[model samples]
Target: MTRTRWKFARIIGIIAASILLYLLLGVKTYLYKASVFLPNAHPNEVWEYVADFSNMKYLNPTIEDFEIIEENGNYNHWQYTVQYKEHLSHWPYLPNYAKARFSIKPDESKSKFFIKSFHTTCLINDFLCLNSESEFSFTRGYSSHGVHCDEEIAYECPAIFARFCEREVKYQRDAIMLNLKRRFQ
Candidate 1:
């Protein structure tokens, strides 16, 4: 009985120490990038859809919902819920929403647009992410008949959560790009 109790106490102590160490871990940064070409999409129309923050629900599968906190001439401030796309057994600590300020600004030539989302919240995803920023550029096809889109994301999280965050981001991006293609072309 004494030996069994000692073993149990040691196990509990180890688990506690592991949890404490994880909580103390510093943030790990990640960069994600993806590009897509829409042959049947016109640059103007694509810009209209991609630049609108209100259309996030249609474009991103991970966005369960979004609320516009403020809107200016060329900028939008919104809060969005990021829920698990797949069935998660149980995760109560994950943040359900994040706040961000985004801008859709046209270039001097008016043929390209810079779209960005700057996370205003702590980017707290229950230790999954500490900070995040997204940028997208939509340019008129050089000589083709469509639009060229480039997307990049820079985020920081604990190293243990990096893989999961990266994978989730990629999955969401793939879905978003596919939806954009379907809607425009």
Candidate 2:
């Protein structure tokens, strides 16, 4: 086949795959919840570390850029764009130029921290997901050994993108937790 023909064939294949993926995904939203525990870390210390959104790019290098839209002491509303160089853009976890927002606030007693994130836009050279919301709670507790810290997150994403988005989101969360655990350890 000619080079032009090969390019055309590849484009067609991509379109067909996208259509098939959309069909399989349907129109719906999915919620994903996860929990992770950090050892040797106080709740307040962990909360302070996670709440600092600016430093997240270092924690998760996939973040291309991070900005603080609003801030109030430990409580902050922030936005960041992610850039991933995965083998396939359709992998969901590696959306090119994905944008998201995150913020959290702790309760009066400073025992529990509440977090909310809106993954509003995902672009693969084009607009993709409309919206995905994730709410999280971080708590500092005690165990027989010492400080016991736990964090839970509830995530909601469009079904069409969930296959890809969920995996990427989980990877990001897991990476963050692993780093945090290592720090406290």
Q: State which candidate has the highest TM-score.
A: 1
Prediction 2 global C-alpha lDDT: 0.59
Give the winner by lDDT: 1
Candidate 1 backbone collisions, by pair: none
> Compared with the true structure, what per-residue lDDT tens digits does model 2 show for residues 119-170?
6554566555456676666676555232344444444455665677667666
Candidate 1: tens digits of C-alpha lDDT, residues 34-92: 88889887666777687766577788755655666666673323223332222211343
lDDT of each: 0.68, 0.59
Clashes of each: 0, 2
Candidate 2 clashing pairs, residues 3+ apart or interchain:
92-164, 93-168
Shift of residue 93 alpha carbon in model 2, Å: 12
